[model samples]
Target: MITKILPGTNIELKSGARDADLSVTGVVAMALPLHWGGRVTVIHAGDNTLYPLGYKISDPALKLVREVMNGAKQLILYRLNTVGAKASAEVSTGVTAEAVFPGTRGNDLSVVVSASGEKWLVKTYFGTQEVDSQIISAAADFSPYYVALSGTGTLAAATVKLTGGTDGAVESDYTGFFAELEKREYNVICSTDSDRAADVVSFVKEQNANRAYVQGVVTGVHPDSEAIYVCNSTGGVTADYELTPAESCATLAGLIAQAGVQTSLTYHRGITGWTDVKPHLTIDQQTGRTQNGEVLFVPLYGSPSVLYDITSLTTFDEDHPKDFGKGLVMRTLQKYQSDLQKLLDTRCVGKIRNSVEGRAQIKAMVFEMTSRGYLAPGYMEDFSADDITVTAGTERDAVSVVVGIKAVDTVDKIYVTVTAL
Candidate 1:
């Protein structure tokens, strides 16, 4: 059954079970940086903090929505008390020691089962910003005892000798080892050091072109590596079905854009293979997706455009009227084809007021304005959640706008078209 995160309530997280029980600890569906409306539902769980008020499962098709690793550190409780409970007696966690995970894009969820045939489903989060299939894209070796190694072909350079445990066939050749990789039924995280990441890119590109390759966004991307790193974005020059050349990264700005009125969205990255991985920032809600037209990413410091859409922590209460900013921010970092707000700030004839409640409120306000064309550059309409002071002679506060993160009964997916410069 699907778990629901009701609007307008603050709840702490505990632990949960995979099948019928979810621990008392609220399950975190997606990571942080997620924007929710009053009715948004959660698909994952996490340790106690504040979970949007949650409800129990009633649907079976969505039962396995979140990945459940067999040996990961999750809990196995039947349920918890008031979702907002701050009590410790109602919490528990799994102590298994295996590398299994699950990840999801939209409703598409998959798990990373280990070489030991352990199954998993990482709890995923959908952020206010858009997520792409791209990531750090570095692969390393998982030696005996979950050992980590570097450099490509290292498995070929050495023999893996297993003592006290059942060992399978060993390959002394790198090519042979990798070929065996494709044949293995389990999702094995194998890696070897390489002087340049270019070779890694070549290997991925040679593997497939139609389908975007999976880069290790989390595992091993860093600067000052004693080992080499490479850029592997090269591929056939076919135009991105959803993007144009003008929308490509002009600097360190990577982007994920929408192309149709409401397009199908997906997330792909190496988060699944992270396996008790290292230092990484957790952003974006695990199961939440953005309004159809929203874009999300990090931007250059001096970017002439708006980056970082802060839509987390919005409160959506039904009895209370929530003035939601239809569309406010873009989540992706890149050279944007359309600066939805910049166009509004200067073009619209209303004074910009910070009437929103929180960091997330501002984003909610902006989004609300954009969706109704009040925030568009060409329009002069005003929006409001509440009546406010006008600078003496300024245009009467159009609509005293207030925003919260409750999904509209008739929410629409957003999209944008890319044009090559």
Candidate 2:
């Protein structure tokens, strides 16, 4: 052997790490008692912004937040304020203060100032309960939820109660809200109001088409839309807060956040521990509505629980039958497609050629998922090596792939027959 200078080859081993990031996260948008507008924020478990409650809607997102923190690993929140809402305010001798945000929650604030030694004691009250107190020698030192102080007038022995804080007619800034939401990724999107139910459903459909699939849960009935789950909740007034159809939607959002994609909320409790059916309906009504793809919170074992895990899909097309209307099946399909896309991006993009090796890689991925039960075995019944095709596209520097997938549906019902022997 001749000892000649040779170049060394670098060999590296690489593998793809599986991620469940999208499967365990959820997003909810609603009116909150915070700075208004279409402001979007992310809150994991134990965030202080949701603390020191003061308003009735203080934790407007309390239902969704609590469930996500306890169940789902992450959550995205949107605080929506109606356009042109007036902030509540109180004018005192030496101080002028306004509510932090525009909402009827501000009308409940009361501000009182008293002399304490060398400093003036300013106290903030939320419907008779003192929530904040500050010692101040001048207006600049006053900071409380009841008011934002200003001016040089004497605050000594002065009390001012807020009034005229009208909550702007409830209007949803769907245009702004959706614009902000589309930038983020989430497993589920939940909203209570039906005002923009069509928009929400349409957005989810668009996301799916773009290969960024997301599911939605809504309250009240909406026109049939795939990937959108509908639930009919009570619109009755309760002692603490009115149980509107929207609030019902929020409750379902929280439930979905905690439960796994493979898990069903059927027979699960509503977020508020509410177990009794309000505006009480008979069994026949609940059954009929659910069969029509309405998610009802009916009494199960004398406890309030979800009636079914259904989607707003009533397709009559042969290609997409009613059986594919089930929420569980759609979710399974979404996850399956997501995995396939990931494989393409990570394992096939530039490293693999659009040849036999590339096709084998695609087939191997499908085999792995099916073996692990992510995809049903039925998919492999007639699927041969030719089932996966990775070919060069007509477009410059483009490749195309064709894949066939089959999903196993959740066994919602079963019929059994027995005869006396």
Candidate 3:
């Protein structure tokens, strides 16, 4: 159970409950928020110059460069797609337009879009963009753009300061949105008898429109969050899902992630199984319920989230990974059994490994505390104590330590070896 998400919404359909549809209408408001680290002063005032670090957009990123041209405000829609992964993907977003009502937290923006054409309203967003509404003012000859705004200030609010950026970067999500829409429409109607991808696509459509099915996609996706993200990928695409969702995108993302993975995930409300899917893992109901039975969900943007490192770190190499953390327990217990006395004796010396997945920079350190307990495999206490600095000779008071050696595949494990003193 990856319960890292903050309190929001948890929706699940019973095994066969309400085979009904919930066709949604226009978009009311969509939000995509990224939390910042606590503010800290970086420097003391020198000649009255106080230096501190603050989050700011760079000239290269998609979000920072897509502000509306009319005024300083960012357009809720645009005619172009700019930035993001180089390899383009076609995505479909159901919501088209939205509305905004002044409430407590600044005037909230609502989007109005069609959900199976019922005209739905969404006051919340997963990762939807405001650019979906930027239509060319004049259709045939490419004139100006018409964005809904009553007052001159509304347009004035659209102006953006010219931070050096390329004009070629039109708007974020534009390409993805259009590509997605075109693909989905084609998939729905294309007469391919064997391609069940259409069935899945149709299922998403029903989820949003009628009371029988729900349709959506994952947006603002990242390793830690499970929220589903949907995109229109059209000119300045529109969306309903975000990395942090107020609703179902979480479930949707989990499913997408699970479908593409070897392990499965279960919850109090529903169960997500990677069944009939490519390279999936199954529930180990026979040999007792174990997280080690499947995949190991690693966390990004933070501390170590791998539970059973000692064995999982070694057993599952790179390609043949034991999926979805189903095998977490077994892998973890194997380690615990090896050092039970040390684990139970709190005062004993213990060590852990540190790795930078893509970089392949592997390191380890000794620890003294258990900061958090998220898996059957224990976590380090005083978490930061992990992968401590090891220096040569007199660099950091080097101490002689005994080391245990073993091969990843060979069963003849464990041998005493000497380390830096």
Candidate 4:
């Protein structure tokens, strides 16, 4: 059975449990963090805590968050350092007001001070909408939700627009983010900054090499690696917002994370709220880009849809065949890898004896997980008990297992022949 563990941790699977029973699918991590609080914030489906935490609807970070929430059930928002300066304004002598959160979103705020009889009325406006207001005799006693007030002096009646708010630098370097992200678990990690495409790909490669088993979605650059998915479309327009290529990358990441083992992204699935794709390409262009290992969005069956669910791996070898380029197969393999790792880390390792009986027990566990967990759920086909092998390892305390699985993929194309009689 699937059980909820600690607050920050994802669901854990009990022994002999089906991977689909407790599989933490669609867990997405956002490279950018909100300005309001904490270096990391975990948002679950239908969670509106961001609004109460001072995140505005118009914030650019929220756009990515909203798009991710459209598909993925959970999102981890991480920030490296206190990147931006807070917007502030001097109302009068010894009286100052600062935004509750840092970043360029604060620049949209303005503070208006009006006389209220013997007291002072301070109002915080986000583009003419009063978000917070307070009336008090002194600045120290004034408490507002949107802006923090400081200093002690006589308040004057004036309107001051907060300035000097900046978004800071794009996270082109992932040195800090990777250090912390290594401790977390997620199905997909997305970079919302297209300029950092190369850096993101490099990070994903290193993480995968270390057996992190996480997928990455990035825009612009093509590394031709199985660990990374590249988006090449531009000028996307959604019903609620105009999207940059980077934003579209985040949306795709969410979709990839949410897709179950039985589903394919290109299975007649369109973006949740997309209205149009920019620089519409012809059928030949779509085929050319798909062959180049780039993901593209085009009009399909009268709606904007992903052209193909493929990765950036064009080069193929015995180990990495052409079918490895299919995103669905890769996701299934990664899920198995992650599940096996979790099983070993949690149940075996130093706890289990390294004897023949112990090895057989381990083999049985793997067999059940492979057949009952994966094959029975239609995630894989052509699996047999003979495909799993368990033996003692070269080390005295280690055991080894070899498993073969054929992942299932959705049918996206059909061919029909008509003979006139």
Candidate 5:
């Protein structure tokens, strides 16, 4: 008698883990690459201050960082090289010093060497303030925080100021930034350069098509796409700070990033750290701007608040309803899509078999996940088990899943009637 050989039973375990939080804001700016040597750096919750990260207050990126942190806790900064010149100075014989980073801010740096008895005192100054000082016995033992040292020799007492530093030309093409940005997950992106409006719109559209679900915030130019938010307010000067239109875009991006799926940035949503907006718009002006799909900082309830959480999507078809223009609804939809994709990629993609039972399992899993994650939190409503369907595709290895969801929106308007008897 011959016995047939059988394949061993394989048990694949699936994880019930969820994706990372979707509340990160990305900033693409022409910033000096100081301590972080790479093109990208992530600033955690408490480390939002630029001075601690080797960035002076005079740096061009300082304002952008401050504006973004005013609303968001976490930030991912993309360093756009300006092709600028580095500031350097020759200090005494056999010693040369250069700014730690490039750009015009380095031009404010100066190196002063003074004789310190048995040792040498090297002081690095930013204008009149002495930022860094190191007492060293020899050039080889010298280490400075603000500048890099080269060409070692006997130390001498002299003062040398950095020169020939320039900001150079800002990059017009954002192909590289977009490529690197796609590798990471962020809810919103904004650039300090208003000139990159068209490129930013194109990037947002491509990303949304791929289901990446990121929004772009810009100023001035109007690109009527649901994926883009245009800030049209001609900024304002507060008591402590003055903002331009581009800076306002960064602030709006931050606010959008911090807003959860359950919240809407309308009426009651006020910009953090800003008390008022200058040159307030009239009622008619606000109405006209809103109709044009522009976001404005208007006075609401005696405070500077968002007029409406709107996107530049004036032309809407049946597939893209008027609700799609609302930032709150878009956030809810993007979160759901991103989370579902993550669930499939992690749990169901290669592990599940292409059978009726597997399809049923997928549908049940998605329904339960949505109920617990979204419905329970009030981000979504009117969802039922029938809203999700998983079916077999033409290819045996492929599966098609269709999900329908009703995102909950905030009540921004009310009408009341009073009759006197």
Candidate 6:
């Protein structure tokens, strides 16, 4: 008899040493009218053709992008100006020079064609800065950013400043945009349109009825809407663009993504977006709004940064007097589903047989998750080896695995009792 070491055994030993890494699930999607970038279509982070957003306030495209990015790992921007009017070009008589894309920002652009010795000089100006300048004998070498050259006009030493450029009408194509967004996965989606935001929540529920739950954070239409809409009743108007309710929620989404899987947003100070939440809501009002499934930034002593994390979940939370309606719980559930799916799909699928050995592997991974604080330690005993059932499903080509998970929740409130002697 000889002792044999199997290749599979070696692989198992190596994999067992490493635990499953927690996945980040905070991708955001929104639609906006962007100037000079995107062809009235959907653009993702990897699209190099899309114009990049800058940190400058004058750049509306970049400003909006930065606003959403303040709370998301990545953003999927859809330029919603397909049927809308394009900004009229400030034509210099015979030239086809026009602002790229349709928007009001084109009004700021001006083009100047001058003669510099032999080569004709074409310069585009946005305010005092000369954005584009090119020396070309023909219109073929025109700058793409500022103007598109046209006509067979002969070269001349003359300058004409563009005029009569109008920002064309632009509208959000919510139906088309949402349909496209359905094909991908994102954690938080923020919208200022109340009707669209409500529809988003419905879509999220429908998609997550079986699995993959995503939360939609929207600006409330009113103070009494039953949704995860936030309010900024701050008395003073500050210049921070992030002070807007929608942007604030986007920031909160980012915070939740970076936070622990089992944490709550209660008392977690909002990021550097808002200076203060004013009009100091009474305790009763705050409680009522939360009961109606609305979130608000509360003023606490010197800071108005406290974000009360409440979900727009109305039906189930009312029946159960727990923190089930809290955004933290939804996030924890997302983490649990995402991590478990990853564990099963990557490690358990096809690698191990559906037998006692496979069941053991599943238990090991679950135990590891518990050890890492992703799952509650005290609930480990509930995750029995026998609890994991890998069996053939109703479909011939399908295998279903059923496993129980206990997610740890954050402590939001504390009550103390004092007895006087």
Top TM-score model: 5
Work out how many backbone clashes candidate 4 has: 1
Give the TM-score of each candidate.
0.16, 0.70, 0.20, 0.81, 0.84, 0.74
Candidate 1 on 1-421: residue-level lDDT in tens?
Answer: 3455886656667775212211112111111111111112222334331123211122221112112211112212111111111111100121111211111111221112122223221121222222112111222323211211234331111112111111122222234323433432111111222232234334434432322212111112222111111111211111111111111111101111111112111221221212221111124421232221122221123222212222221344663222221222111100111233233344333544433333234444356444453224323234344322212223434433223222211223368899999
Which of the predicted structures, 1 or 3, would earn the higher TM-score when compared with the native? 3
**Model with the higher TM-score, candidate 3 or 5:** 5
Whole-model lDDT per candidate: 0.23, 0.61, 0.22, 0.77, 0.75, 0.56
| Clash count per candidate | 93, 3, 98, 1, 0, 1
**Which candidate leads the pack in lDDT?**
4
Residues 230-326 of candidate 6 have per-residue lDDT tens digits of 4333221234433455545554555554453545667766444456665567888878766666666776656655446666655564543354566
Q: For candidate 6, what is the lDDT?
A: 0.56
RMSD of 4: 7.1
* lDDT at position 350, candidate 5: 90
The true-versus-predicted C-alpha distance at residue 359 of model 2, in Å, is 8.6
Between which residue pairs do clashes occur in model 5? none
| Better structure of 1 and 5 per TM-score | 5
TM-score sort, best first? 5, 4, 6, 2, 3, 1
lDDT of 4 by residue, 195-219 (tens): 7778778877787788888888988
Q: How accurate is candidate 4 locally (lDDT)?
A: 0.77
| lDDT-sorted candidate list, best first | 4, 5, 2, 6, 1, 3
